[model samples]
Each structure stands twice: as structure tokens, then as C-alpha cells.
Target: MVKEVQKRKINKEEEIHISSSDSSSGDEKELMLKNPLKWWSLQGKRNPTETKRITLPSTIKLIYVTLAFVPRLALYGLVFALGQCCRAVAKLFCSSVGAPHLANKRILYISDYMPPQVHGIALRVSQYTKYLRSNGHEVHVYTCCVESRARTSFDHPTLPFVANPFNSGNQISYTAGIKLAWALGAESWDIVHVFYPNALGLFVLPACRWRGIASYCSHHVAMDDYANRYLQIPGSPLLQRIMFLLYNFLYDACYRWPASYWGDVNASMTQTFVKRHLPLAAKYSHVATIGSGVDTQRFQRRIPTNPDLLWLWCDSQCASEREALCKRIGAPTNAIIWLMVQRLAPEKDIHIALDALASLAQQRKKMNKELDVWLVIAGDGPAREGLEKRAEQLFTNDKNAPGRVTFLGAVPNARLPSLYRAANVFLTCSRSETFGLTVTEALACGACVALPRCPVFDELYGHVLPESWRYDADDKCGGHLALIDAAQAAASIEASAWLEANPIDASWSAAAQDLDRQYDQAVKRGKTKYTSLRSYVQKRLIHLGRASLLLVAFYFVLSYYWRNIYCAAQCRIFLPSLPKPVRALCILTFIIALEWCHC
Candidate 1:
């Protein structure tokens, strides 16, 4: 649902050139135009090759561009205008058209937080519910709420937000499921969609299935990939096998439906998690690729030029990578500014970034007799103060370092786009990732991303990094070394040995470029395919809604006529308990219900 909105909002104004144009900038463009020698690029150039190749769909493509692209864009504009006519009118139609399937289908969205949580999954959940409600569907989101914080801009007060377990991470929402399911039992629901297959989904999967309800599990992250480095050690193959078996048992025993795992790229650990235990892929044939939701409304490709801003890296993964980059550039400590937007947990390995920065500061003082750098840390977690003290201790030897490093805890979701825009470059150094949503947002915002070439990272960028910069951890440059240490303690050292035994094709830079080009091609192809399907879907939904209205009206009228007959037999115009005016209102309602049936 989130991805649909994103694809729909791509206006004609955003020129998507198949061939590399001279003026495009940033990583996204760089990836798209990586292969200048490709057929797409060659066709645009003045090359003399006249050899026959696949001909162009010039007439058909033009017709499609004119009929589908142009009209839909114009229609979209009209819809926007209609919305402005009145708040309710706009909300009703946009939401309705956006999610017509919701009218007949009761959707239960089990998530961690509705909104005000900056993570990708949370924002998408909020959007899905809003659109679903707009379509007149009985949409309900069940999650725990923080009492101190108010609802977010996207959150509607009337929307139900059931409170439960409170954890900084969105994955831990087990406490709310029992109550949520109990509340939902009263409603006639067609399907239950569970998010983050690891935690909340695990809890909700079985109960929904037992009732013969259509169930879906959106595997946002594979559990094996997410476990702390300690759990991945090779010596613990027995434990690893045990964990994998347990996970497989829970998923297999519970779900008869095809379980879906959607992620940016298939990480080694995630794939291994499946192959080691769930050997047969045929069991979960419903596995399809559903990319993470992109908020087209919030993030656009507008490169902000703030002269005062030296760097703007989100605190998630790039901290350590940025430190290495700073060292390679030999940047002056003060001239270099770094931002770390991450949970201040010990496992995040933020201290490595900090330690590297501090080393740079000392080197600058010894060589140039002066060094200055500002480290801005965002996000609050259990290790916040501990990280702060460590930061202070590391920089104690410096003269201007007191005010240089600042930790502005927990910036809100609304401010992130601007933060990405303000910064010159973005960095993320996490050893593992399930397609970092922030990384995509940062790239879209036009910052050069400095990221490790992990499976998820490679998948996210479509393998579009410069060859010199790409690191798959298996490369001679110790790219895969970090992962080695992470998997050292696995139940059997064989898992780690197996990982080391087979090296990945570490051609991420070219891969990223190819991925982006393919994505553009996909978007172009998908638009046409999507348009046809969308129209069909819309028709089906509208028909379903009309049919439902008819059934509801028929029920109301039949009940009314029966009541009138009963009243007449009693020798009374209406029931004695009901007032005359109330009886008349009931009659009026019956008439309206009849009208609804006809409409």
C-alpha cells in the first residue's frame, strides 16, 4: 500500500531519462548511468553501428505515455483539487480511491507504533490505516503507546491505538496481541496482516489461522540476520541449529498459508537461516518480493545546499565508515563535522567511530598544532549517558573539543528529511542491514552515501557503489572480516567456516549501478502493467463496495418491513417502547437504506 502511493505520485515533472544525461548528480543518478557503453546509452549517442537489434515501441510507447501517463497525472491533479474543496471531501475520496478493497475486507494491522516512530515500518503502518479508513474499510491498528508523547501529524485521534509492551525497538510488541485479538473477535474480518515476522507476527500468526482467517506474514527481517554478533559464532552450530529449528517449527507448525519474506536483498544469514532449517522452499510458495515502503510525500530528490553544514550522516550505520573516510581524506578535525543518528546501544559499535575520530583529533594537534571537529549525536537509548561519558573521556585531551561533540537526543521524524537535506554527506557502518530505509531517504535527498557493501546494503543500492569503495566483508581488504568475528561463536564453527569457504562475488559497485538501471527499467515497465491492473482493481473494489451497500440496504429494508408487519398485527403503528418520532426516524432510515441498496 505504501509503495503504491509512492509509485503513483511520480509526476511527469520528474524527468526519468533512460540514457545518462550530462547534468545529473548524486548516487542514484550515478548508479543509473554507470554503464555508458550499455545499449540504452549507445542508442542515444552518434555511434555508426546500424546492426539490427530489438526495435523501439515508438508508436506504442508514445501512445502509452500520452494516454496512461498524461491522463493519470491530469486526473491525479484533479483529485488533488477536489480534495481542497473541503477537508472531509478530500479525505473521503483520496482515502476511498486509494484503498477501495478495504470496504468489504476487514483488515487487522498489527504493528508496534502507529506513527511518531521514525522507523519505515511504523510510518507505512500509519499510512496504510489512513488510506484504508478513507476507503470505508474497518481498519484497526493495535500497538502500545507512550503516554508522555502526543500523537504524530499523520495520526488521527479517533484511530484506535491499544497500549502494550513498551520497548525502544518497534519489533517488541508481544504484549498487545492478546488484547488486540480479543477486541477484533467481535468483527467479521477477511484477512490479518502481520508486520515484522520476528516478533509481533510470530505471536499473531497462529491465532489468526486457527479461526480460518486468511493470514499473511511480511518478513521484514530474517531472525538469523538480526541476532547480535555473539549468536552468530561458528562454534555454536548446535545452538545456531537449535535456534533455526525452533524458528522453523514455530513458522511451519503455525502457518498453513504460504509465508512471505520481503526484504531489500537476500542476506547470507537470512538465506542460511532458511536453507539450514526450512530446506524445502515449496512449502512457502507465497514468498514474493515486496520492497520497503518509500514515502514519496516526505522524501524527494532536492539537494539542499547549506554552506554552514559540513556533513549530515544519519546516526544509524555510517559512523564508523565516516571515520575511515575522514582518515583517508586526512581532514582537519574541526573542519570535519560528523553526525551519528543511532540508538546508543553497546552493540551498535559506535565507539569505533568515536575512537577513530578522537585519534584523528590527536594526530591533527601533533602535526598542525590545531584540530577541531564537531560530532553531533542524535537518538536516545539505554547507553546514552555511557556513550556521552566515553565521548568526553576520549576528547578530554583536546582544547576546543568540549563543545565540539554534541549529543542532541531523539530528533523527531518530521525533522529527518530536513536533516538529510542539510548535511553534505551521509554515512552508515552497520555490519548488517535489512535495506536501511533511512539510507534510501538520504540518497533520495541527494547525499553521497558512504556504506559498507553488506548483502542488504548492496540490495538497497542495487549494488551501485564505486568499485574502490565497495566491501563485501570477504574481500582481501578485510571487508568480510567483521562478519567473521560476528559468526565466530556459532553453534558449529562449520557455519562460519562454510561462510568463509565460499566468497561472494564482491562486485558491488557495478552491481549497484546495474540494480538502479534495472529499477528504472522496472518502473517504466511496471507503470504500464500497474496502470492496467490498477484500473481493474479499482473497478473490482467499486463493484464490491456497491454490492455490499446493496446487501446492507436489503437487510435493513427487509427487517423494517417485518417490523412494520409485527407492529400492525399488535394494533399499534409502532412498538410501545419506541416513541412515534423515533419510529418515524426509523422509517426514514429504512428509506435511506433502500436508497443505498440501489446506489
Candidate 2:
């Protein structure tokens, strides 16, 4: 009776919306208001007859540029000399604070992203730190603070920042170059693992070389996919073609120049990465993928379930809390919730999941299964407003009236496990992931997954999950057809109880052990026992053969063609500059300053 009253109230509201907005006769008003995206097409949000883009921010020209490259050699030389002096002083007086004993080494985890930022990289670093500690190694994390809420999740020092203009400030760690350099000069570590090659990596990796520390990286950014997304002027393919040079420069800067070694073992995967992502593959690429891991213990807690079954797993408190959550979210008591937790970015392709939901709703009435499907999207991003409106349109026919889709804004990571467990199936349409950490987290929480056809997904979960778990989709129609198939596959996973049979083996200890093994090998090879002058300069320039070459050519060209720019007073323009001998001698000295920076 109460539900009928609620339904009457919703119907009255719908009638008002139909009358006020559409201006159609009473009958057509109901029909028109039901399909929002279609209504949007009619209202010029999108026009099917003519190609029109979603109203977007004015395109910014993001072309990468290099300026005054040659003239900075003297600055590079002075910095290098000062760095050498600092390293010498650090070694002479500071006397290595935490000395490494046999097998177990003192490790430093350096990254631009860590907790309070809330992303995959942050989670990875936190998990690695925790597990590495459990492995009896002393591990410390140095990263930017995104908030001041007093993070009990992980312990570290404070002072501030890491910024991501690329990700629209989603990942932030900033003004930390000097702080990190100071740390490197003051303390010592066996290994420093950088999670992202943000601006900090530009010189920090070089500092690692100067200090005789083994610096490693875990590659997370997929720039080839990212470059095309951001570095373009809409409706100008010609300008975009020119922008490829910038793309190539950034790819080299971010992926190639940053680290000496990264974790990756698949040779075929490396070749595929080089073929697709690289502008030009380096002749020497390291391949030893230790692989990323998930903390199973974090997700093993039982979510609030039925009171009758509370004793079987969770206590009465969990049941009470979960009931509160369901009531708060307006979840249908008997409905099968398909939860998706991710930042609602366009690249995530959430619309596909909505289309899939629409298809499932129709099929549920006709099919014998009679699914009570609900989609709960827990996230917040720039795309949230549009997605919410579209989702409302998609679930317009939901008998519950307020809609089957729930938009839970910006859920904290601490609450994610409960959401994962309460959810029947974890669904995602993201094809741009370097590593889909959420998928692993969902699996760890015992929720089955439905993922898009992505290479990284295939490599990581191909063997881990059943054949039906992953599906392919079309760009023309998005993932409507394919995600329905994925949903059906997920139903099968639920029925067969696959998660019960095969538990995931992504323990952090195993990952730490792999790092320990790599460190042992590096130490055996006599890495970082001493920081020398020749080795410090030579190794960096040699490793980045092309940057070294570019640096050399830049200085050479400036000295040859643009000599007067540097030596205006030294050169005599009919006695307006120095004598030929003095000028030549000064230019020679200028040429010599470029020596330390290049090969």
C-alpha cells in the first residue's frame, strides 16, 4: 500500500515534468520524457543527422616544446658539480644512517602518488610498503600529501604535494624536487622505487645515479592512449598531426628517460608495448615483471548480510550497519546489485554499462531468470553530471520510481570492500588501464567481474578467470552488445561459484620477495657500494643515449651558429667584440662547459 502511494507520487511528478518541459499532449509527454538521451538528441544535446560533439571546454593547445636547449649546458655543469660536492660531503660526514644487513635491505618507496590522492598507484605503493615490512625489510614511503586528515592508513613524514595537470589534478604531489634532493643527499637507501615518472623523476633519477642508489620504476601511465586523448584541437586533424612530435617528446620524457629498470617479465608484452606505444623502441629494454599484487586480508571482512546468516560469517553489528546502508542508498531488498566503483571519467566508458543495464531490464521481463538488476556507481568526476542524467533516462522504466541506478558520490577507499562484497557483480568498461587494480580488489572481495577487452586485462586475468569473463566491444555502438554478454557470463560465474573454487593469490609478501630477489642480484653486481665521479656522469648519459646526443648537438649548434648570442662582449664586431684570439679562446672555454652534460 505504501509502495503504491509512493508510485502515485512519482507518477504525479513525472506528469508535471512531462507537461512543463516537453509541451506535448498528455499521451506523448509520458513517452518523450522516458528516453532522456533520445530527448537530448531532439533538444540538440546531440544531433544524429549532423555530427556534433558534446559541449566541451575550449581545446587548449598542448604541444610540447623545447626552448634554449643548448644554452643550459653551463647550468647543467654547475648543478652536476654541486651535486658531486654534496654527495662527497654526505658520504664523508653523514655516515649512512640505516645500514643494510645481509638479505634484508633498507628500501625507500618514492612516488608522486600515495594515499589521500586515492588512485591505483597510491594503493600499490601502500600495499608494497606494508608487505615489504612484513617481509622483514625496513621500508619507508616518501610522497606528496594531498590532504591533512591525518592518514592512519600509512605512516610517513609531511610537508606537501604532487600535481597532475594531465589527470586534471586527480594525482597530486608537487614542489618536492628540492625536498627529495635534500633527502637523497642526507640519507641512504638500498633501493628507491618510483611509481610514476612525473616531473620529479626528471632529475631525481639522476640524483639516484649520483648517490650510487639503485633506482627502479613501476610503469603505470599508458601515454600512447593518453596522448591522443588530451593533445588535440577538436575538428583539426592537421594540427593534431603536427602534435605527434610533442607526443613523441613526452613519451620519451615520461617512459624512456626516467628509470634504469622497471618491473616486467613478459618479452612478448614488451614487444607489443614498443610496437604500439613507443615512438622508437630503445635497443636495450629491461624485462623482469615482478607483477603487481593485492592485499587479500584487507578485503576478507564480511559485509553486512542477513540477520539469519550473521552468525555464519559476520556479527550482528555488520547486519545492522549493512541494513542502514541499504536503507540509506534505497537499495531494493531483493534486487541483484551490479556495482561499479571508479572515477566517472569519459575514458571509463560508463555509458556502455548503462546501455547494458537497459538491455538487462528488458530481458529480465521476458526471460525465465527474472533478474532484479540494479547498478550502483560509486565515484565522482567531471563527467558525473552528464552520466547521472543519462543513467536516470536509462532506468526511467524502473518500477521503483526514484530509479534503479544510485550515484554514491566519491566513496572512501576504507568503505570500498563492503561495497565490493555487497555487490553481486563488479562491472567496468575501461579499456585504457595499464593495470586494472579495482578488478583485482573486487575479486579479492569475492565479487565476480565483467571487464572489457583490453590487452592488460587479458595478460593479467586471462589465466586467472574463465573464458567468458572478458568480452570485446565495438566503438560504433559502444559496449551495449558485448557488455550484455559479459553480464550473462557474470551470472554464470555466480551460479558456478568459481570464486569459491579458486582463491586469488596476490599476496604482498610474494611481491616483496620478488623485489628482494632483484635487489640481491643488483647488489651482487656491485651496485651503489660507492658513488664515484666518472661512473655517476657516465651511467646517466649512456643510459639515455638520445638525450645525451640531443644535449651534445644542442650545445654544438649554439656554439657554431649562435656564438655571438653567448659571447656578445667577448667577440669584436669591428672592435664592438673581442679580438679574434680572445674571442676564439672564450668560445673554446664555452664549448668546454658543455662537456659534463653530454656523453
Candidate 3:
């Protein structure tokens, strides 16, 4: 009875053990499915009796299983644990700081062009860089030496390339990447901010990755629209198609690839641009909608000297230069000056403004009103000659058309504020503008802007600008009529009063602050990614080292058993007559086969 009771107790204990082990295994499997990284924990807590009961053919099989499975389990566990720890630390830090700390950042700016290149992007970059420097940040620029006049400039050597076929002024360079990398290595830059994804900017992206540096890129131009409209190789459709494909490929390589691979922060000037182009902004981690900033204080309203004399501010230094400009393009002094400060390019749709001027003159003449109107086009481009010829043709029939239109080739940036002050109205007919910098400047200078009703214009100034200032570009007659009405309203005291009441708040200081926030976020993200990668590598190496030790132990165990079996075989079995060296080699081969089969 006592023996039977002992047997029953033993059976009950065994049953309990099996049940506990089964439940534990089930829980582990479920956990593993949820997170494979937790699999290592199962090994240490496994039933010892279960391990003993599981018989294998050889030690080699045991070693192979350990090498293949155990290391992977440990590696996963280490990586998962590290990741969790990092996340916890990050949360704690963020809770403490309220906002990420941003101060004294070493910023590197890479661009294709900077001022004295008369474009919106160049001006925007210059303003941002200047403001960044003023705000106690170390800022450096890397760009082509093409035509820059900045005293403290670093120009990357470049190969000539025509960016826009319609305008010679759009010529840029493909910067040497190797040279740029060397330059970057020499500097201890904290952040690399690329203005536009041209060759110089694109080349530095990989280098940023190699050096473990955070990178950012700002989308400035609509490359596809520009290419489709302007990159025309006339008389060859195949060549045109090829060129189009090439340009698109270049765009993708330069812009999209760098943004994905190296960029910690990607930005666009307008919310419209961010929404449209970078729909994957959330997926990329950091994206910002920081628009261009204007020097509102510098571009303030200055009282004109004469109300009757229409002032056309173009690229002229003095009275003699202005007189020569007037003579070259027959500009009237007494008429209301309709100022156009833009590059003379087809993309600008300067002809629309010219056509509007001609129509306004005809309407005034028919109404028995004084046709005292002069159109002044400021800035120069490839289309200037053609535009001048078109202007001459429009005014030739009328005997009193000597001072109807004039071209002020190119204007100095310093003189723009005074020019804005002098003009009654500012006009633009650009179909594709990423951000209308000049328009903002004109508005800040107290001149009412007469802009066509495009998406960009509507987005920037639709709500802020008065109804009379906005015009329908699609409607030829109505658009021109709207332009005329806007011009007339600009001359009124009521329009000036409205502008004063609703002052433009697009300042460089605000934009710089927004950028500073973006930079901090980027740095935080970059540090997190770098830390995760380092932890993973270190854990993998540790796991690999543990697996190697198991293999070494298995080798020694196999050698010991083989020697014992070989001696026995040699003395009493098949290999007894064979030479010692040959017999030893045969036994070693047999052992390897057995090991392979079992594994």
C-alpha cells in the first residue's frame, strides 16, 4: 500500500510538471509571434527534464542546432531590449524639455546659385543665410563660382550646363562631387541644408551618409513644369523625348533620391507645394511648410517726389542711365508708370502684361480719356529683343507713341525698395511661380500688386490683397480689364490706406525661427537612428561570438570520440592493415560524413 501511494504521488507530480511546461511553451510561442525578439527568454526558462529527454544522434547535431537557432534568438532579444530602452529614454527627455533644445547649430548650405543671380530662389537663400548667421548660428555656403559676388564664399568647381533653354541666364553647373566631399570632410558641420537639389547638393547627400551627418533639402522649383514648357529641342521629336526623359531622370536622382536616403528634414516654401509634391511627408519623418521671408523694414513705403511723373525703376544708376534707357525704349515721363519687375522670359508671360497695356491705351483713347500710360519692363533675359520689337510694332501707327514703353534691362537689388516706392503699381503675369518674392516686397513697400489669378498667387495673396488687385489670367479681355482697374485703384488713397492697415507680416525673423525648429527635430531623429544602428551591430557581434564558442566546443568533443573509435577500429577491425596516416585520414572523413548527416 505504501509503494502504491508513492507511485501515485510521483505520477501526480509528473502530470503537474508536464501541464506547467506545456502552458509555458504555449505562452512563449504567442509572445514570439507578437515579437520575435522575445524568443531568447524561452531558452533560459525551458524545462531541464525536457532537454534531457530529447535525444540526438551526436554532439555535432546539438552544436549545429545551438549555432543556427540560439544566436538568432539572443540577437533578436538584445535588439528589441535596446530599442525599448532608447524609446523610454527619449520619452523621458522630451517630457523634461517640453520642446527640443535648439542653439548654436553649425549649418552648411549647398546651392547651385546665390546672388548676383537675379532669381527668387537666390534671394531667398541669401536672406535665410543672413538671418541664420545673425541668430548666433555658424552658417557656411557651398555653391558654384559662376557669377557670385559674396566676399566670404566657397565655390565648388563645376561643369557648364544649360538649365533652361529659353533663358541664357538660367545656365548653371554640375559640381564635382569628389571635391565637395573633401571640402565637407574638412569642416565640422552639424547640419547640411541644401537650397535646391542641383548637382552640388545631390553629390553631398551620400557623403553626408558616410560621415553620419544630418541633411535637409528645400524644394524651390517645379522642375517638371519647367522642363515640359522650356526644354524644347525644335525640329526633332525623338531628341525632345530623349531630353525630357533625361531631365526627369536627373530630377529624380537629384531631388527624390537624396530626400529619401539622407534627408532628416524636407521643406517646401508653401503648404500647397508640401501637400502636392511631398504627400509622403509623414512617412519621411520630418517635413515643414516655411515660406520665403522679405525684409519688410527695408522694403517700406517711401513717398514719391512727383505724383504726375510716372517713375519706372529698372537697372539704372543715375539720370543719364535712365535717360539712355528711356531713349532706347521710348518711355514717356508724364504718364502713369505701370512697372513690371521680372525676368523677360516666356514663362513670365510678359506679353500678357504688354497686351494689357496696349488694350488699356486703346480703351482710354476711345472713351475720349487721356491715353497717358507708359509701360516699363525691368530686368533682362533672352526674350528682351523680341519683346522690344513687339512693343515697337504695337506703338508705331500712333503719332504720339514715342514714350509708350521702355525696357530697364536689369535692376540692382539695393534700388528695388526705392523703385517700389516710386511706382504707382507693381505688375506680374507669371504662370508658374513657386513663391512670388518680388510681389511680397512690392506689397510691403506700399505698392498695390496687380497679379494674375493663379493658384500660387491666390494662395499667397488672395485673402490679404484687395479684390481689385487679383485678375483672371485665363480670360483675355476680363484679365486685362481687371489689370487696368487694379492700376487705377492703386493710384487711390483708399488702396494705400488699406495696405497700411493690413501690413505684410512675412518677415525673415519668423522664417528663421521656423527653420531653427526644423533643424532641432532633424538632429533628434538622426541621433535616434544612429543609436539604434550601433546597438544592433554590437548585439549581433556578441551573438556571433557566442555561436562561435559552441562550434569550437563541438569540434573538440567530436575529435575526442573519433580518436577513441579510430584506435578501436585500427586494432581490431577493417582499418587494422592500413598505414597509420592513411587510416587516420579515412576515419576523419567518416566522422565528417556522420556529422553532416546528423546536422
Best-to-worst TM-score order: 2, 3, 1
Q: Which parts of model 1 have CA positions greater than 4 angstroms off? A: 1-104, 116-120, 132-138, 146-186, 197-212, 221-282, 301-334, 362-373, 399-404, 467-599
TM-score of 1: 0.47
lDDT of each residue in 1-599, candidate 2, tens digit only = 21211121123323332222334555434445575433332322221112222222212112111232223323444555565566554443434543555566777666777666668777777767776777888776667653456444334544244234344445444324444555665665676666654444555566666556666655676666656555555577777777667667765764565543322111112233434443232433344455566766566544435677662456564455446556756665555677898887666778888888777777775665544676788887546656766766666645533366777878888788877777777898888877677887888777788888777777777787887877786646566877877766785646338886686767666776776787666544335345455557755654576565578988887667456544654435433456666666665566567654564
Error of 1 at 475 (Å): 9.0
- Using TM-score as the yardstick, the better of models 1 and 3 is 3
**Candidate 3, superposed: residue stretches over 4 Å from native:** 1-103, 146-149, 153-167, 183-187, 235-239, 278-282, 302-334, 476-478, 535-599
Expressed as tens digits, the lDDT of each residue in 347-378 for candidate 1 is 45555556555665666667875544455566
Using Cα atoms with residue i matched to residue i, what is each candidate's TM-score against the true structure? 0.47, 0.67, 0.65
> What value does the lDDT take at residue 223 in candidate 2?
63
Least accurate 10 contiguous residues by lDDT in model 2: 1-10
